[model samples]
Target chain A: MDNENRIIITVLGKDKVGIIAGVTAVLAEANANILDISQTVLQEFLTMILVVDLSECKIEFDELCERLNEAGKKIGVQINAQHESVFKYMHRI
Target chain B: MPITIHPDEILETIRMVELENLDIRTITMGISLRDCADSDGKKIADKVYDKITTKARRLVSVGEEIQRELGLPIINKRISVTPVSLIGGLKSEEDFYQVAKSLDKAAKEVGVDFLGGFSALVHKGITPEEENLMAVIPGALADTERVCSSVNVASTKAGINMDAVLTMGKAIKEAARLTQDQDSIACAKLVVFCNVPEDNPFMAGAFHGVGEPDTVINIGVSGPGVVLNAVKKHPDVDFGTLAEIVKKTAFKITRMGELVGRVASRKLNVPFGIVDLSLAPTPAAGDSVAEILEAFGLERCGTHGTTAALALLNDAVKKGGSMASSYVGGLSGAFIPVSEDAGMIRAVEEGALTIEKLEAMTCVCSVGLDMIAVPGDTPEETIAAIIADEMAIGMINNKTTAVRIIPAWGKKAGDHVYFGGLLGSAPVMDLNKYGSKKFVSRGGRIPAPIQALTN
Candidate 1:
C-alpha cells in the first residue's frame, strides 16, 4: 500500500520538437519516476502515453496532474493524468 | 517493455468523461419504511422521518467521497423508501401530506437532490386508505420540493386499473394547477407506473418495495454520450456492426456503475443492489439518447425505423449490461424524455417527433411517454387515456413503463416551458383535439391480458 502509486499520463496534439523533454521535465520536478513509455505519430499528430510511479511525488496527485497539464499547454499539447487504477479496472476485466 | 494497459482504452474512457459527459447518474439508497408504520398517522410520519434521516444521514458525504476518490462524477445521491400507501396507518390526505413533508425534510437534511417512494401500489385494487392517498398526491407533491411520488395502477399480473388511471390524471392536473406559476413543475415530479420495479434507483419512479432488503444501495449508469461517441466512430457501418459497437460500449459503462455500486455499498455498510443500465439523457448537447438514434443515420429520431432502431439499442444494452454485472434491473433501456434531451426537443420542434411517435417508441424502449409537455387546455381524460395506452403497452409486453407528463399551464403547443437544470425545458407538444372522455370514464379495469396466463 505504501509503494503502489501508479499513474498514467497521455499527451496528444500535433507532433513537435521537445515534446518528450517538456513532459518529463515536469514529471522529474514532481519526483515522479517514469516506468513505461509508448509514443506514436499518426498522420502528423503525436500520441504519447506514459506509466509513472508517483509514490514519491513532491506535490499532491491533483497538483502534479495540474502541473503536467500546464507543462503540456506550454508545448501546445493536451495532457491528461489519471490514476492507473482507472485503466486497470476498466481495461483488465 | 511489458504493456500493462492499452493506451486506446485509457484515452477513450478519459475522452468520454472529459469531453462526452459520461457519468454515473445516481446512487440511490433504498430504505424500507415498513417499520415506521403506526396506528397514529403523526407518529408514523415522525418514525418515517427518524428512520430515513438516521439511515441516510451520511449518503451525500459518502457519494462525494466516492466521486472524488474515483475521479468519476456521481451526479446525484438519492433515497427511496417503502411505498407510503403500504404504510397503512394513514387514513386521510392530511396524513399523507404529513408523511410527504417528513420525506421532504429527510431528503433536505441528507443533502440529496430527490427522495422517492411517496407511492402507492394500486395495480390490483385501490384500498380506502390508498384511494385517500391517491387523492392527496397532487397536494403532497406541490408541498415538497424534492419529494417524488409514483402510483402503480397496472401490471401484467393484475391488469389495468382504469379507475386509478382516471384518478391519476385528475391528480396530475391538480398538481399542475398547484404549480402553474412554476410551469406545472410539480406534475413533472409525479410518475404513473405499470409493473413498477421494487429496486429501481431512478426517479421519479423509484421506491423500495416490500421484497427489498431493509437497506440497500443501487446505482444508475449514464452514458448516452459514450454510446453515441462509439456509434459516431462507425457511421457508415451496417446495423449488425452498429449493434456490436453499442453492446461493447454499454458493457464498459455498466462496469463502471457496478464498480461504483459495490464501492458505495461497502462504504455505507449497505448491501449492494442492481445497476440500472438506462441511457438517461440530459439537455446538454452530445448527451441526448435521440442523438444516439440519429447516429444510426436516421434523418431525425421519429422516422419510420425509429422503433426498430430503439428495439435493437435497448436489447443490446441489456445484453451487454447483464454480462457486466450479475445484477441488472430497473428500467434498463434507453430513456426518451423529450424535455431532458436536446435532440428530442429539436426533433419535436422540427415536427420529426410527436407524442404519438413517442408512444409508439415506448413499446420498444424503457419508460413510456416520459417528461413530456402538453397544452394547458388538454383535458384530464386525455391525459388518462394517454396513461392507459402506455400502461397497456407495459402490461401486454410484460415490461416496465411509466408516464410523467406536464400539462404546462397556460402554455399551448409550440410554446416552451423551462424548468432548468437536468429537468430542462419542454416545448408543449400538441395532443389530439378529439376527446377520450367516455373511454376513460368506463373505469372498471382493462382485464389482465393473456400474457399473464403463463402459469
Candidate 2:
C-alpha cells in the first residue's frame, strides 16, 4: 500500500474494554492496514486515533467511513475517517 | 517520513467546516486583457472572450477537484479581467455592450458564477472610452447574466471625482429602472469604489489592475462563524484576551486560505496572488459578520460602541492574516453588507441599524455602504451625495471603501426586495429626506487631500 493513501480514523467517547478490539475488527474485515495507533484516557473518557493505510482496502473510502461509523455507534463511541490531506493542510505548512 | 497528524487539529478543522461554516469564499483568476486590445471594438471583443476562456478554462474543474480531494468547501470560482475600459478603442454605448456580451459569454463557458472587470477607473478623470463605457453600464448590466461592474471615482491621492460620482448615481438609477421587475437586482451587481483593490477575489468589486501579472490566482477566505465560536469559548476573558483569541482563530483561517491559494496556483500554473482575509458573510444564520460584532457584547450591530468593536475586529484580522501569509493584499477586514448578513438585516428591521451608523462603522472596516437597499423614490442626487460622503471617508482616511446601494424599484421603506442566493433579501432602508441636489450638481474634482502629498 502506498503511503499517500493513508487515512486517519478517530474514535472518541466513553472509555470501556474491547473498544480497540471493536474498531480493529472493522478495519481487518475491510482489509485496511493499521500502520500506527495511539490511545489516551482522561477521567473515564477515551480518545483513540489510528493511522491506517487504505490503499489496499477492499471497500471504497466512503463505504469504509460509513462502516466504521456504524461500528462505533454499536460500540457507544463516535468515529470519523478523513483523508490525510485534511490533516496535513490544517496542521503543517 | 510518515507525516504526523494531530487528532485535535483535524477535529477542530472538521468542526469548523461541518458546524461553523468555514470555507474558501472564492478563488478568482485575474486575467490581463491588455494583449487583447484593438482599434476595432468588435475585434477587441472577440479577443477578450478568447483570452478569458483560454486562461480560466480549468478554474472551475480544478476548484471542484481540490474541494473533493482536500475536503474543503470552495463556495465560488470566478474570474476578474483587466477593466474593460482599458481595452478596446470604442466610441459608443453599443461598442461597450458588445464587450459586455463577450465577457458574459466567456464566463458562462468557463462556468464561473460572476465575471468582474466590466469596470472603469475614473478616479482622476474619464477618457472618452471610459465615458462611453459609463454610458452603457445600465444596458450592459441588465443584459448580462453574470457580469459585475465597478467605477472607482475617488482615492486618497486622486480625491473624489464629483463628476463621475454624479454620473454613477444616474447610471445606478437607470440600472434599477431597467431591472425593476427583478426588484432592481441589476444594481446589486454594481459597485462604486474609492481605493478599490486590484487582487480582491470577491465581487462585485474585483478587477485586475494594470500592474498585475498576465494571470494570477487570488483567494478570499471566509470564517465569521469560526471566529464567533472562538470568541464564545472565552466569554469570561477581558478585552485583551478576547483580542488574542480572535487573532489566533484568524491565523488558522488564513492558513487554510493560503494553502488553497498555493494548491490552486500550482494547478493553474499562475502566480499566487494575495489572500484576502475579509470575514464575508452570507444569509446563512451561523455565517454572519454582524453576529460576530454582536458576540463582542454589542446588543445590536449599529448601536453605540459598534464602531469600536468593528475596529478591534478589523485590526486583529489584519494582524493575524498578515502573519499567516506574506502576500496578503486586498481589503482584509470585516465586511458589513446588510442584505448578505442575517444579523445586520435583523438589526435594520428592528430599527437597531441605520445608514448613518453604518457610515460610521465603515470608518473602521474594509468597505462601506455595501448591499444596502434604499427607497425607490430616492433622488439620484441624494444617491450621489451618499456616495460622495462614503468616498470622502475613504479619501480622508486613506482606506479602501465602496458603495453598492440598491434603489429597489417601486419599493419604499419597510418593503422587502429579494435577490435570492448569496445576495439574500433586504428591506428598502430609509434614507434622509433632505435634498442634496445643489451639492451633487456642483460637479468638479475635489482636490487631492493633504495626505496625498506623501512624497
Candidate 3:
C-alpha cells in the first residue's frame, strides 16, 4: 500500500458508547476506507487506533481531519489523524 | 484489510508527538549570495534582498503545509545565507549595516523566524572590509529584529585570532549597552564561534558555507523530552543498558528528522543537505537536556559525573542518528545553553551549575559557553578572555564551539535578564573577578596547532 495515501487515526479519552460509531461515521462520510481498527480500555481510558486508506476519500486530508476532530468533540474524545508514513518511518528500520 | 504495522507502534508515535515534545526543530533553507555581490554597497543590499525573497518565497507556506499534513510540529522555518562578508563590495560600516537591514527585511517579507549570515569568517585574520562589517554588527543587530550575526575567531587550521576576539568582546558589551532597555537582547542574536559549522541548521550560528550547493535544506531534530522519558522508563538499568536505551530513542527521533528533511526538500525543490542530530532544548519544562542528565541519577546537572553523563548521551545520540541518516553534520550533540533550558536555569539559580562547569560540559557535548549571562559591568577584556579560552578548546579538540554570552547592562549577578520566547531568561551568573586585560590586549594570532598538519 502507498503509505502517503494512508492515515492513522487515534482516539483517546474516556470509554463510552458509540465512540467507534461516531468516528467511523466521519470516515464513512469522507469515503475513507478503514484498513484496520483496534480499541482497548485500560484504567477507564479509551485508546483506539485506526488505519484508514484515504485514497478514495471524497474530501481533502485536512478537511477529513477537521471533520473527525469535530465528531470527536461531539462524542467527548480527542482525535488525531496523521499520515501513516510518520509511524512507519519512526518505528521501522 | 491487511494489518501491516502493530498497534503499539502507532500508539507510540502518537505518544511521542502528543505527550513528549518531539518535534522537527527547524527547516532551514541555505541560500548562497555569491551572485548578489556588486561594486556599490546600495546595489549589494538590494541584490541580497531580492535574491533571498525570490529564493525563499514559499518556505514558510510549504513548511506550514508539511506540518499540517504530517500532524508534526515544525517549530521554526528559517533561512541561512552565505556569510555577508563574502558577499563583497560592502566597504564601509554603513554599507554593512544596510546589508543587515536588507537581510532583515527579506526575512520578514518571506515570513521566516530568523535569517542568519550577517557574519564574517575571520578565524586567521580579518580583512579591512570584514573589520568594517564587524564594527557595525552591534548596531545592525540592535536595529534589526530577524537578522543574526556570527564571527568565527579561531579554528584548528587557523589558531585563535586574539585581535578579532577582543573586537567581538567590545562589540558584545556595546551591543549590551545599546539594547540595555531590552535586557541586552541584541547579544542574544549574536554568536562568537570557534570552528563554526557552515551547514549548521541551528540559529545564531547557521550560515550557508561557500562549498555548499546554491540552495539546500537542512533539518535539526530535537526530542530531549522523548529521550528523558525513554531513560526514565528504565530507571534501574546499568550504564551500558541506559546508553542503549538512549540510542534507540535517538534513532527514532533522527528518523523523524530525516523524513521531514526529505519531505521539505522535495516540496521546496532544494537539495537535502544533512540532518543535525542535536538534542536542542527549549525554555519549556520537560524539554531540557539538563533534565535528561539529572534523570541519570545525578542529583543536579552540574554535580560530579555530569560530563560523563553528557558524553554518554551525546555519543549514543550520534550512534543512533548516524545509522538513521546518510548525512549527519553540524554540531550533532547535546546543547547546554543556560538561558534556553529551564533545568539549566534552575541549576544556575541553585548554584549547581557555573560557567566553568558549563565549559567542562561543552568538551563532551556540542557548542561551548552557550546563552550564558554575566554582570553588565564585566569588562570586555574578561569577555574576550572567556572567548579565547573556549576558542582554544575548539581549536585543540577540532570541534565546533561558540560563545553567546550576554553582558546584561545594569544587571548584576543574581539578577535575571528576560528576552522572552526561545531566548529565555537567565540569572546573571558571577564571573572570576581577576582581569585578563593584559593578556587579551596583546593582540596577535595564536599560531595554528600541530594537528592542522594532518595532511
| Predictions: Cα RMSD each | 2.9, 3.4, 1.5
State the lDDT of candidate 1 residue by residue for B1-455, as single tens digits.
Answer: 35587878877878888888889999999999988878898899889989999999889999987775566899999999999988868888889889999999999998999999999999988999998889988988988999999999999999999999999999999999999999999998999999999999999999998999999999998989999988998989988888899998899888889888978898999999999989999888899999999998889999889999899999899888888887988889899999999999999999999888999999999999999999998999999999999999999999999999999989899999999989999899998899999999997998998964567
Clashes of each: 0, 0, 0
Error of 3 at A60 (Å): 1.0
Q: Point out the higher-scoring one by DockQ: 1 or 2.
A: 1
Output candidate 3 Cα RMSD.
1.5
- Ordered from best to worst DockQ, the candidate numbers read 3, 1, 2
Those runs of model 2 whose alpha carbons end farther than 4 Å from true positions after fitting are A1-33, A38-48, A53-85, B1-3, B452-455
Worst 10 residues of 2 chain B by lDDT: B1-10
- Give the TM-scores of the predictions, in the order they appear: 0.92, 0.91, 0.98
TM-score per model for chain B alone? 0.98, 0.98, 0.99
Winner on lDDT between 1 and 3 is: 3
Clashing pairs in 3: none
Tell me how far the alpha carbon of residue B239 in candidate 3 is from the true structure, in angstroms, after superposition. 0.8
**Candidate 3 C-alpha lDDT tens digits along B279-332:** 999998899999999999999999999999999999999999999887999889
Each prediction's DockQ? 0.37, 0.36, 0.78
